[model samples]
Target: MTLKSALLAVLFASTAAVAVAQTPLPPADPLDDRSAKRVERMEKVVRELRSIVFQGRDTGKPVVVQPAETDAQIMSLNQRLSDLEQTLTRLNGQNETANFELTKANRAAADQKARADALEQRLVALENAFNDLKTQAAAAPAAGAYPPPPAPPADPAAAFKQAKDLLLGGDYGNAEQAFSTYVTNYPDNARTPEARYWLGETLFVREAYTDAAGAYIGAIRGWPQTTWAPDATLKLARSMVALKKTADACRTLDELTKRYPKAPANVTSRAASTRTAAKCG
Candidate 1:
């Protein structure tokens, strides 16, 4: 039998033992003395023939119980049965307490499992986001990452034309770079003076008057006979005036009017205007 059934059976036997102990024998007859004597015979027969049943959990073996003869024996057996009942009651209470603790433990474990599952889901989402960022980085390059490398066109005329076009288009930064490149790569080319003069133009329009003056001086010294030479000299005077060097600028304009006598009328008029503006002697 199951342990619960076994304990129940033991309890049932204990109850039966109590009932048997409580049974009253037949009462004596008042007119018959022998009938009263037969009461002792009835009691002895009950004591000899009586059997009780008990089973142990370990062995599952039935134990034969003898009936109690004396009052002391009966009382002792009753006390032990009462003690057993109290012990069983206490054991049952402990079992219920254990079952309750076990249920709470199960609930705690389930809650922890749920939290762990949620954390795992979040981790997976983060990993997917990281992978998406990695994919994007692989697909596209960074902005302003690669600059145009150093380039000097093979043909000096084409290069000069490109630099001049850039200057005319008002792209001063690239025009400066392109003209500077042309000057460096083709110093002896016939177009170099024109390129350097345009370089000064790029600087002058940007209001970098000091750099413009230097570029004009380079063109005049390097290609004095070129048509760009007189142009560069006039611009040089203007650049010096922008620098607040009125004396130098006036002397330059004076030299220009004398040295390049056949200079453009516009150059002569600009020189006169600049001389008047500065009150040149």
Candidate 2:
């Protein structure tokens, strides 16, 4: 070979080697379009550089060529791609964590609602049970399950005296109960009217004016001629005054003076006071 031919061949070989060395590698991700396009452009630039070098050699002229991207710039782009991939992975993890927390919060809210519903149901059940107990308690007496009535006295006169003694001893509560039982058991007894009058005295002492008035009327029925009748008539008028029945009280006072003309001095004096209180004419 001639010396000039050998120099051209060496120059062509060196230029082709530089072009091969400067060619960039294919991108790691085949689906990355920008990287793939960059690699394709680099390859095309290398091919064009090789074509220019071969043409220069044929025409006896030197050709200069430069690479599209430096080594540092390529490395920087690869690092940026790796950072972008890592950021995507971190974002995906954060999204998963957020979704998990949201689901857990929803479950907790459902649990709280279920607990509240259970508590409300329990309260309703407890209220219903209390109402049932109240109903049963109210119905006990009607169903005949309550305590029985007390036994009747063996001797009606003896019972009447004992009840009178109780009243004299200041035990008005027991005296009232005893008189009430005596009147109920021996309704047709000779002393029943007097028992009723004493019952009215017991009720009057306790300020049960309406009940005392009723008992006094029961005692004075038919205007019995007993020793207690004059006092009973006076007490009936006083009970009527306490009951706010001024007209009834005046009529009762008039009946007392007409029926018992010689009532005891104390009873007549009390009757006069009661008539004044009642504004009797």
Candidate 3:
């Protein structure tokens, strides 16, 4: 063979062997049995090609011309190695794609499981709430089956003090009942206007704004000169605003400024701000 041709043949064989060696090996478990076997066979073929390409290298034969039959055998081995490598490449790509699809499917399954668990918990909460309500309804007394406790006695000072204590103690529900009872039992008491104002305050703290307005109105109109009167007027306007009765609240604030001209500076200032927020003319 010509010297240049022999050198070219050696270079080509060396390049092909190195390329095959650098090609990544297939993973042991890529979820495709057939692809795994193909990769395994490809690896064996690469090893055989390496043996053929460098067979006499240890004996100092980098490139050796063989008989025609040996050359044919080398060519056959090279062709088979090339085919095996192509098959391995295709199989590895397909395996990677299939693995990605499986990962997506697993993620979707986990997401569905999480949603189902959340739904089950919500259903359990709803069932528990319904059962509690059903039990409460079953246990509740029919109308007048149980009468309310006796009205607070008509001791004007002591009764009103008890209700006021309940208010200060943050027992707003009982304070509401106590104040209502006090107003009922001692409507003509000397502290009736103050009592009414405090009742409105109790309701206001409990977010019963409409009821608070009625009680405040009582304190303002029934006993206008009482110490509670100015504060009650202020609170009545605030309660009207809270109830979203914009016009009524604005009119009430106007009335507070006009009718209670001697009201405190802070009360007047707050009413002005309230008027602005309510967009009053």
Candidate 4:
């Protein structure tokens, strides 16, 4: 054989062997089930490769002769193709590993974001709770501060009724107690001045002139704008007269008439005034 022809034969044999070896082996069938979809897909790919090779052979562009050395050449090419296929498989494995890492990383990132959102929600809740606590504290009264008790309610009607009942019953001690109770219990009651006036009258009837005069003065001070004032003023002068303090009684009676000329107790007041003027003169 010619050297160039032999070389071409070796080249063609090597190329065919390389093509054959470059084809991947079918993946192992799971449980020997060669009828699975993956096995079918591998068969389809093998058929496509054989079809492409048959078409290339049929094209017949150049004449090349087979050489006696073609077997070794074919085997060497197949080994190279197998090496290339192994390299491609390794690259595919690396790609799949990279995709798996990417998926894991994405999931981790989502978890981290979820944790961050949860922490943020907790922080907001804590802030709101703190603000609510601050508001409650601001609304609270100062320490050591207490509200004062309200003033005791007055019973003016009850006080008057009890005083009148006492005076009518003629129990002097109980009557005085009732009037004093009225004064103590209903200091601002409208009947307080009247109670004092009655108290003075009760004392006067008991011949306690000084105490009666004091109570009458109290009545005048407590009920100055009322009709009881002039009556109490006149009674005060009477009380002084009973105590035999003529000059003092005269002065009191004179002042009573001068201060309250149109008093409802005008007759009694004027009469006392006249007696006081005569005695003093």
Better of 3 and 4 by lDDT: 3
Residue range 187-273, candidate 3, lDDT tens digits: 887777788899999899879999999999887774376555777888888898898998998888888877788888888888888
Task: Compare candidates 3 and 4 on TM-score and give the better one.
Answer: 3
Candidate 2 accuracy as TM-score: 0.46
lDDT string for model 2 (1-281, tens) is 97567657766775776677566565783447886676567566656666765766677776665444666799889999999999999999999999999999999999999999999999999999999988998878465332333444689988898888788988787888889999998999988988999999999998999899889999999998888999888888887888899999999999999999988999999988998999887
* Candidates in order: C-alpha RMSD to true structure: 27.5, 22.2, 17.5, 30.9
Candidate 4: worst-modelled 10 consecutive residues by lDDT = 144-153
Local accuracy of candidate 1 as per-residue lDDT tens digits, 64-135: 554446767888989999999999999999999999999999999999999999999999999999999888
- Sorted by TM-score, highest first, which candidate order results? 2, 3, 1, 4
Best by lDDT: 2
Model 1: lDDT to the true structure: 0.78
- Ranked by lDDT, the better of candidates 2 and 3 is 2
Worst 10 residues of 1 by lDDT: 46-55
Candidate 1, residue 234: the lDDT equals: 83
Candidate 1 has which clashing residue pairs, if any? none
Select the stronger candidate by TM-score from 2 and 4: 2
In model 2, the worst 10-residue window by lDDT is 143-152
